[model samples]
Target: MQFYPKGREQRLSIHHPSVRPRRLAVLRAAGVNLLLLQFLFLGLFCYIFGSLFQQSTHIHQVNVLFVDYDGGAIGEAVRDAYKKLEGPGFPTIIERSASDYPQPGSIEGAVCDINYWGALYTTANASNALTAAFAGGSAASNYNKNDVLTMVWNEARYPTVVDSALETTLKTLSQSARVVYSKVNGKQALQNLDTSDSTTMAIFYDPWTLASTNLQPTSQGSRLIYNTLVIILIMIQEFFYLGTVNGLYVQFKLYTSVRPHRMAIVRFIISAVYTLAGSLCTAGAIWAFRSGWQVNGNQFALSWAVLWLFAHLNFLVLDVFTVWLPPPYVPMALITWIITNITSILLPFELSPGFYKVGFALPAHAVFQVLIDIWSGGCNPQLYYALPVLFVYEILGAVLSSVGVYRRAHYASIKAESDEKACEERVAAAVLQQQEVQLVRQETLRDAEDSRSSNEEQETRDARPRRGTVTTIKDQEELVDIIRREMSRPTVESPEDRRSTTGPSFSLPFTE
Candidate 1:
């Protein structure tokens, strides 16, 4: 998802951020990621999204609103026939709205909501009108005035797939109506309707001939843009986004000593080269599978060159935001892709709401017009208008990219870094002051506890009963003298002791 710093190893060895990848080293790394590493986005775009448009050109469910006003056998028969007709893939969802012929000019607005591809209606007395033709009236008889199946279509609602599908559906309904009418009238003459020689099939039974006003006319190949070029461009732009996001790794680029403008130039070169290769591959696939070799291959090349130019311009424009407003790149890409690709390209402006025209400023829109002009042999003449708009985009991108570069230069230089270092030093000083305050408080608590214990010991010693408290100070000294003298005195002579012993002989209980 992201490119981490490649210079991390070097940064660890040498603490200076200046020891970084040189200009060319950064460019080489970028080129590898841009051209070689980007194939996954390319493959995904081609294989997944490209295959999507190729397969999804046709609507899976063709919605049909059967508005029958005739109240006749022909209308009833066509309704029954439509139900029986089912083909492979998404079946047509038919909403059978039976009514008498809607008021003139009212059908167009009713179908404008575009929920259905087309509508089939019948005029009054559809059976009576077909009766004349069944009675062997002129095969060229006016089928328009008679009861005939009418097919109404809103060409602006969808592209050619729906257009052709609507036509085919109506034709099928017409055939069913014809067969049912012939059988009900017992006209065995019409049984040969399937024969190649049958004239009624085209002249009388054909719905286009039945009611000419019913089918709205549309220009040929109008839908080709939606199914082909638009889808291809969308996929290509999706592929381009992966490479462009590399611009978002500003910190890595900044650490690597690559200047923004220089990096932008490298990016432009790499993008142009990859764009050339991708554009060729895309054009080849489209030509081989869709257009074939009939069209000039030169036009594809021409269109691709212009497409590449616009795509790169778009990348540059996006890069401007990435450099200046880096954080929002992911959401910015999503929002822009949805708005530009969905509103303008996938949903043709003609088929989309009026606000979709805002996407004309998108490079894809202008490039799509140019591509269309090239593919369609210059019929649209959008080259004049589209090219100017694209040129304006390119110019605007260049200016904004330069502004982004200037902004980066202002931030990434030594002056800014010096200021940052000074700010960090101030913050470190403040933290050291806090640590000193805590150490002082801890030392103060230890000293206070030591002083308190010393005081308590001194107080205990003073409170204990000393010899001075037991006797007066002078008397205590005399007592000590008397004790010392008594220790020095020897035993007295034994005369008294002998006399006491002789006298004690008279005592009965005297010890021997």
Candidate 2:
């Protein structure tokens, strides 16, 4: 036997249709519609294009071999300068064999072919043919070659002028020293073999060396930070997208009378699943095709932490939006987009001028920066500091969403109660009005019958003798008495009244 009443069962079957079967059907339909393929294509495009764009723009340290052919004092000085440039923070320097000289695909220039900004080259010769070659010159005709040639030639010419100036200055100093020595000692003693010593000359570089003057080093950290920031920003957008979708679904279900807390829980689960899946897909695609994106186990752990925090932050924000702004998904979506874009996730925060620093303090900004730092082998002291900020945002979002859900649910309950009370009041008023009308009709009918009986008795009295008229009056009085007795009898209640009294007896009645 069916457990529920027929009407109730029908209503339940109509309103709470089998969601699992419907969901399965929808999934199958979506699969057949090829929407999944579109999503996959979009995801792949984002991953691949984003990775390539990041790699092209972001500068990083790369391994390079620097062969020094110039063993002379100047060459040795330049080589020593280059060697001093090697540090733990910069690119790794590798030594190459003599055979490795003039090697093809050598990263021995100022800029790598791959745009890594790291290069390796030999510097043993004072006139570096490789430098000239890098400067875009033919090895055959070395004169008047390239821009680098002109620069280096000009640099060499300046040193010659400097040497000449130094010679003049030293001659004056030696002459002064000699004059002092002559004044201190005898001129004859100073004149013995001092001519040879006086003829001796030496030159030294000025306070600023050529190596210091020519070299302008860029920071590896800056490029890494910027590129990583862009990638993380994109990831933040993805997180927000997924979170908003899940939140909207949850909010729609709740609007249909599903439990808000349960819906929230389900939304969180779906969000986590989507986040994990997307992250894995991104990581896998990058690993398979783009090997340059480096991540150690520790760094990976940090990245995951960053991703998790970002996901939760997005989820909370979207949940709050969903609760506060239901029905029109477009407005919420536009608002979210505006907020995200303004947070400096889509563009460089520094480019935002006065508000950049403040924008960077937002949850999306903090999370993106943290992810960039983790991915690109950099560190942000502010990331640790910003954790509390993100936590606060999350807390506020959760509290506000909870409050909104509670208020909405309470309003729905109150509305339902009000509607039920109004329904009962309408029914009761209709029943009472019907009963009054029936009583009025009965009273009118009884009066009409009494009038008709009196008329008939008068007619009979007129048709008989004068004595017969008195008897007719007695009969009429008796008829009137009988009618009064019938009218005095208690009336039975209507079926509707009995039902109204019994229907809600077991339930608490609502007062309008």
Q: Number of the top candidate by TM-score? A: 1
List RMSD in Å for every model shown.
Answer: 32.0, 23.5
**Per-residue CA lDDT of candidate 2, range 166-193, in tens?**
2232223223323343344333333332
lDDT of 1 by residue, 1-512 (tens): 33545434344433345534454455665675456325645643553343234232233356656666767676777756666665533226465544432553455444544445566677766556555544444633555533366666644233454445556656766776567655664455355333343434444444334453332333445345644455546444734563454644443545236666776666567656765676666666665555223357687678678756766676666666556654524343444454445435554443334455676776666776676556545534566778998889777877787676667666667654775577556555555565566556545645565556777756644653353243334444554456446643655658868665634212111111
Q: What is the lDDT of residue 44 in candidate 2?
A: 49
Q: Estimate each model's TM-score.
A: 0.42, 0.38
Query: Candidate 1 has what TM-score?
Result: 0.42
Model 2 residue 249 CA deviation in Å: 9.8
Stretches of candidate 1 off by over 4 Å are 1-264, 291-293, 414-512
Per-structure clash totals for the candidates: 2, 7
- Least lDDT summed over 10 consecutive residues: which range in candidate 2? 148-157
Show the colliding residue pairs in model 1. 69-99, 126-147
